[model samples]
Target: MDFKLSEEQQMLQDTAARLVRDAYGFEQRESYRRTKLGYGADFWAQLGELGLTGVPLPEAYGGFGGSGVDSMLVMTELGRGLCLEPYLQSVVYAGGLLAQLGDDAQKDRLLPAVASAQLQLAVAFEEPQSHYHLNDVQTRAEAVNGGWRLSGRKVAVIGGHSAGLVLVSARVSGGERDEDGIGLFLVDPQQAGVRRRVYPTVDGFKGCELFLDGAFVDAGSVLGEPGKAFAALRYQQGRAIAAQCAEAVGAMEATCDLTLDYLKTRKQFGVAIGSFQVLQHRMVDMRSELDQATSMAMLAACAADQPDSDERSRTLAAAKFIVTRAGRYIAEQSIQLHGGIGLTDEYAGSHYAKHLVMISHQFGDDDHHLQAYSRLMEVC
Candidate 1:
């Protein structure tokens, strides 16, 4: 496959990079993080104005209907900026799920708003005990006269605190860990019987814990069939993982750049440390890891848009595993090379290091994906 980006893709990447560079300086990012929303509302609006928010949605909803590679271009810029926006949750993951599984009416109502950034969405799929297993849903949904009544707790719902709508996974029939009987429900955060406790994540983003006690949603609020959303959930997660890998690659790139610059300037015994062979070798190793991660991210992005299959699943698992490991290694090496300054909050390299470390814990860690790849290999 050709690795060269098309003209349009290059332009898209440039646009995203410019926007991020201008609006997301390190000081500006810290100010945004202090806000109640945990990010700059204006920057999000800028994304919509630039049409970046709609890159992956359908054309009918005012989106560009771009592919996963298109998303990778935008996400890399966001990652390089260490942006705190919820593009991965709202646009790529939740929007993809809505487009894939929502009924016509649901799409007509939500997709356009989402594409325009007039509405933000969050997905709540993890429970306290699920441990990265998408099929392990304990939240229960009982069919009611006009809708479904849901009761359970969802943990670490990124962007859920501010989202207008949250898509929750609930078990409609089978056991907690069963693959079947899973349903995705659209929930209003402000409605009765729902409670949200918001907190700032270590990575400088905000997320919430959702407690549902008989939360009610009308029949129309369910996405796809009630007891059959596991496949779509898993598929969309694969796409998110691909985007996340791209983001990690971007962070790794930034970290590597910062470390290289530091090595060339920081002096030890009257000469630049970069002139030392040992330090030069370490910098070279960091660059090598970044290159490997970039290749795997490209593979993951390509696989994300393909038709779902064992091959797709296996590829994504491997890509995520490799990217996570590479990100951690880069983060540690950058910090070690930067010395005490690398751990300072005021330094951009330190923030990039934190972002890289946090990326590993997001969807699944290295071990989780490694086990998943192993399972797929056995099946193959």
Candidate 2:
């Protein structure tokens, strides 16, 4: 298999890197973080103009007709910039689901809006009771005369505060955790019986807790098949995992570069700390981990497109698990190498470090993926 990126892919990567470097300075990022939106609105619009908003969608829908590799490249730059935009929520989670399962009408209506950045979306899937359980939906979607009435509470709806649309998961029948009988519906947060309490995460992102008490939706509101969305949901989640791993790799890369800069500039005992053999060795280890994470990210990008479900799961789990390990090592090492100021808000290391922490816990932690990898090994 050809491992190098195509020329088009290289241009995409370079464009992403340049945008992040030029538009996202540390002070400007702080200004954006202090806003109520918890991210930069204008910067998000700029991403749309640059065609990044539709990296993974089809060209017919105003996208660039790209795939996992393309999306991975953009996500790495986002990570390096420590971006707080809702790309993961709008593009990867909501758009991926709609593309994979939405009818032609649904795709035509929503995907174009998404690609043009006219509609912002947040996915409501996590519950207080279901920890990282993608199919463990407890929200009920009972049949009404002409549609369905949803009733359940979802906690920590990422990017909900600024979303123009929300896609929800609800159980139509079967048990709470059953993969079958699960359904996804498009709902407006302003609709009747929908209550939201928005808040900011420690990593400087906006999220919300949604209480849906009999929110009504027409039969047409269902995005995919009536009672069969689990497979599509899983597939979207695998893609998300791959994209996120790439982002973590980017953060690790930035931290490694930042730490090296610090070592070269920060002097101790009238000499550059970087000249010390022990310090140089430590930086080498950090760089090595960053390289490993990058390789794993490529593996994940490829795995997301695999035809076999088992292969996708195994490879994604392995990639996520490795990212978790490598990201933590890089973040911790960065802070230690930079001294007390590494975690201070004035410096960039703290922000990257915090983002890495958040990424580690997202979807699943190291332990979660480690167990999955072991189980896959047993099956093999």
For residues 1-380, write the lDDT of model 2, one tens digit per residue: 78888999999999999999999998989999999989999999988888899998888889987888998999999999989899988998799898888888889899998987878999898899888888889999999899999999998888988888788999998998899999999989999999999998877778999999999999878988877988877788888899999999888988988999899999999999999999899999998888888889998998886774677799999999999999999989899898899989788898889889988998889998988889888887
Judging by TM-score against the true structure, name the best candidate: 1
Which has the greatest lDDT?
A: 1
Model 1, stretches more than 4 Å misplaced? none
lDDT for 302 (candidate 2): 81
Computed on alpha carbons, the lDDT of every model, listed in order, comes to 0.95, 0.89
Misplaced by over 4 Å in model 2 are: none
Lowest lDDT sum, 10 consecutive residues, model 2, at 303-312
Q: In model 1, how large is the Cα lDDT of residue 267?
A: 98
- The true-versus-predicted C-alpha distance at residue 177 of model 1, in Å, is 0.9
Cα lDDT tens digits, model 1, 1-380, are 79999999999999999999999999999999999999989999999999999999999988999999999999999999999999999999999999999999999999999998999999999999999999999999999999999999999999998999999999999998999999999999999999999999887899999999999999999999999999999999999999999999989998998999999899999999999999989999999999999999999999999999999999999999999999999999999999999999889988888888889998999999999999999988
C-alpha lDDT (0 to 100) for residue 25 of candidate 1? 92
